[model samples]
Every structure is written in structure tokens, then in C-alpha cells.
Target: MPETYRVAIMGATGAVGTELLDLLAERNFPVEELVLLASPRSVGRELTFKGQSIKVQDINQIDFSDIDLVLASAGGSVSKEWAPKAAAAGAIVVDNSSAFRMDPTVPLIVPEVNPEAVLEHKGIIANPNCTTILMGVALWPLHQYQPIERVVVSTYQSASGAGARAMEEVKQQAQAILRDEKPVTEAFPYPLAFNLFPHNSPLDDRGYCQEEMKMVNETRKIFGVSDLRLSATCVRVPVLRAHSEAINIEFQQPLAVAKALELLHAAPGIKVVEDWDANYFPMPMEASGQDDVLVGRVRTDLSHKCGLELWLSGDQIRKGAALNAVQIAELLVKKQLLKSKTVA
Candidate 1:
């Protein structure tokens, strides 16, 4: 029998955190003990796990000595402060925030593409952004066939990527607009009902949103191709869950659509759902709540050599956050790197 792990989930009350709990149960991850941690505001709230109620605890007060792994999705600031403390106490921290992703010593991992990177972690392993994670999963298989030189991608990300509050904000605003009342815009900069926002995060000096920059940087790191060129446009769509992307890639060698389909079909963690003639393609509704990244609409790019264009979709909360983090933990366990001494 495999050794059961004692796990702690930081931000257990949020959307991604809640999804993490569901996934842990769904996958039947060997959990000898589970600790649910949240902010002070959420303490004492009841959350059901494995058919039993588990009370949420304030993350600030918990001791981490017994935790085998810490899956943190609380936010970058919270992760920045607490992840190291958990690590120092001999727990392998798999963080979902951007806090430690770009750190030279911390391995940013996507289990399908870079599981080996987990072995190089210094107690903390970073999960790639939701958009980046799905994109890398689809692109890695193609890259292995013919080296990709550059990519241009546009994302239609859902509100759930922000949090449960953002999801509620969209729903509430839509109803308010129907009732002729002014819609609230606290969670987002603009009304997210029947509209789209081009900026997914604060703009950098170069005019790219932080979310876009993450896709560009994190892709390079995960693929181990630092000089690869990538340009992205990330937009916030009004959809409640799942993110969709249109990507065009320029590769070193020519790849046919039939061959590309073959490669993608065989890729791990990817599902091909293409049937253009039948009016079938990857969609947000279908991708929501799914664990696999769906790919379709494969064709030749008109403007570039060895070029290919495709559409991809996945649950931003699952493939993007929770499931990916848990998958990393599974990889650590499979690699025998989840042991406390290995992390320390």
C-alpha cells in the first residue's frame, strides 16, 4: 500500500480551494489526515470532506510540523508569507499563486509537461497560471515533434479565475442590469455582463497585463526554452467558468493537420474534440468541470512557415489551479519526493 499523506489546504474557502477539496476526494488521494485552512473571516465554517464535516481553521494559527504537503491557493501575498514557513517545517509546498513561480530556485511545474522539475524543488513548487498550464499542455506535444519558434495566443478567460466573489459579481450584475439598476463593478473594473474586458490584470509599462506576461514567461520556463518568442492577449469574458484560447504557432519544421491531430491525440492530459464539419469544437460549457484540456480547430496558419493554428479550452479552476496542484503532489509521491526529509 502507498503511504498516506497528511495534507493542508490553504484558502480552503475560496473557489479554487473548494475545487481542490473535491478533486482530492475524487482522485482518492491517499490522505491520512486533511486540514482545511482559511482566513480569519472564514474560520469555524463547516466544509464536508469525504462525507464528513471538517471545520475550517485560520491559517495564521496552524502548526505545520505534521503536514506532508501544503496546497496553497490563498493568494500571492498569503503564499509569500506562509509557504516558506510550511517548507521550513518540513512540508513540500505546492503553491497555486504567482508568488514563487518565477523564483530561480522554485520549480514551476505542469505535471504533464514537466514532472521532472518537481524533483529539483527547494521545498516549494510553483503551479503555472491557469492559461499557461493548458497552453503548455497542448503545445508541449507539438514542440516535441517540431520545435516551436514563436506563438501568438489570445485568451477568453472566465470570471471564476478571479474567485468566487467575481463569479457572484457577474451573476449579480447581470440580474441588476435586467432590472434597470446600475450594475456593481467591485470585483472587476467594468461591468462583466454581456461585455468583455481586454485587460485581465493591471497593465505593465510595456502595455501587457500581468496575466499576459505570466503566460509568456511561464510557458518558456515550463518548456525549458528561454528564448522562445510568445505574445499574448488575455481578456476577461463574462463566462462563469472555463477559459478558451486561440493559438497560432510557428515551428521549425512543417507539420500537417492530420499529423498534428495524431500528436495531440496521443499527448497526455489532452483530449481532442474536433469535428468541424459536424459543427463540433471545444467550448467553454463543455470544458467546464473537466480535468482534461480539450483541443480542436487545427489548421495551417496562412502567414507563417511551418505554422499551425488551434483552439484550446479547459477548466481554469481545475486544469489551471486545483487539479494541476494535486497532480503535482501525485507526481511528488510517485517520485518519492514528498517525504519530509526530501523536502527539508
Candidate 2:
């Protein structure tokens, strides 16, 4: 019989949290017991998992000693407070937040790009930012063919990246606009309906927002290239889910468009969608709810012989967040790294 383990889904009622629950069942993870954890106010709220109704336990009161794996989709502050505790208690925590991503001791991972990194984790594994995960899944294969000299990317992020409330805000705002009424704001400072804006994350002195910097630094960490050159502009569009990115990559050698397409098609976690006749390429609508990153529009940069350009879209919540975290847990189990072990 397959060895089943106890699994905990932190922040069990949020957008990514809900997806985690569904994925655990859909993927048929070897789960012996499923625990739903949330804030105090959410305590007693029941969530369904694999046809079983599990009540949300207060994070503060739960004992992590018996859990074998924890899929944490809670925000950073929540992760910062509890991830270590869970780890110390012997649960391998796969955190889907920015909390410990850059920590030298933690392995920041995308299973498709760096599954081996899971073996090096002390206790917690950090899932990359949504945009970074999408880009890495699509570009890592190409980078392996030839070292990437530099990368320039601009992201069209969707409202779902902000959270469930933000997604609702976009819908309500759009409806208000259609009715010729004023749109109210809470999740964002500005209206996200019918208008797009630069990512609202805190801005640094370099004028790049925190979201943009995550792409630069996190990509370097995941690729094991400390000196990888990358610049990104993250913008939030009014879409409900999924994210789109335009990528320009400079390589040491000139890689042909046909070769790029061939490589991408052969790569796992990527689906190449292109049709010159229709001028159609990967779009957010098609990429939503997909596990694979939809990639297409392979072309040579007109200016630089060694530069190539491409476009990709992926479901920010699925592939970008929940699915990636689940994949990491799957990797750990497959490698037998989820044995009886505790963080030192």
C-alpha cells in the first residue's frame, strides 16, 4: 500500500488556499489526514476535501507535531509566524509566500525548473512569486540550451494575484462602471476596472516596485545564477485571473526562432500556442486554469542578433501558486524526503 501522510492546508479559505484543497484531491496525493487551518475568526468554518468535511482550526491552537506536510498559502506575515514552528515540529512546510524565499537556508523552488532543490531544504521550501514561476517554467529550458546573458520582461498581471477580495473588487467595479456609477476601492488604492496600472507593490529607490524586484532576484536564485541580469515591469490589468508576459532574452549565442519553438514544445509545463495566419498567440483567457504555461510568438529581436523574444501566459493562481506548491510536496514525497525528520 502507498504510504499516506497527514497534510495541512494553511489559510484554508483564501483564493490559493481553496485551489490547494481542490488540487490535493484532483492530483490524488497520498493524504491520510487533511487539516484545514485559518485565522481565529475563520475557526469552525468547514471546508470539503476529498468528499470529507474538515473544519477550519485556528492556526494558533493547532499542533503541528502530527502533520507530515504543510501547504502554506497564507500571506507572508502568517508564514513568518508559523512556518518555522511547523518545520520544527517535523512537518515539511511548502510556503507559498515571500516570507523565506530569499533566505539562504531555504530552497526556493519551481518543481519543473529545479526539483532537485527540494533535497537541500532544511524544513521549509519557498514557492516563487507567481510571475517568476510562470517565466521560469517557460524560460528555464531555453536557458539550459544556452546561458541567458540578460532578460527583459513586462508582466500583465491579473486581479487574482492580489487575492480573492481584489478579484471581487474588479468584478464589482466593472459592474459599477457599466451602470454609470462610481466604483468603490478597497483592495487597491486606484480603480482596476477599465484601467490598468503599474503593480501597486511598494516602490524601491530604483523606481522598481517590490513585485518587479522579485522577478529579478528570485529568478537568479532559482536558476542558481547569482549574476543573471533581469529587469521586469509588473502591471496589474483588470482581468479576473491568469497573467501574461512579454519576454526578451539575450543569449551568448544566436538561437533561431524555430529552434526556440522546438525546445519550448519539448519542455515540460509549457504548451506552445501559435498560429501566424490568425495572428493568435497565448492569451490570458486560454491560459486560465491551466497547469502548463502557454507560450508562443517566438521571434528574433530585430536589434540584437543574439536576442530572442517570446510571449507566455499562465494561470497565476494554479500554475503560479497552488499547483507549484503541490508539485514541490509531490517531489519531496517521491524522493522520500518527507520521512520522519525535524528541522534542527
The RMSD of every model to the true structure, in order and in angstroms, is: 1.7, 1.9
- Number of the top-ranking candidate, with lDDT as the measure: 2
Off by over 4 Å in 1: 340-344
Q: lDDT of all predictions, in order shown?
A: 0.93, 0.94
Write out the backbone clash pairs for model 2: none
Q: Which consecutive 10 residues in model 2 have the weakest lDDT in total?
A: 335-344
Clashes (N, CA, C under 3 Å) per candidate? 0, 0
Clashing pairs for predicted structure model 1, backbone only: none
Model 2: per-residue lDDT, tens digit, 257-293? 9888889999999999999899999999999899999
TM-score of 2: 0.98
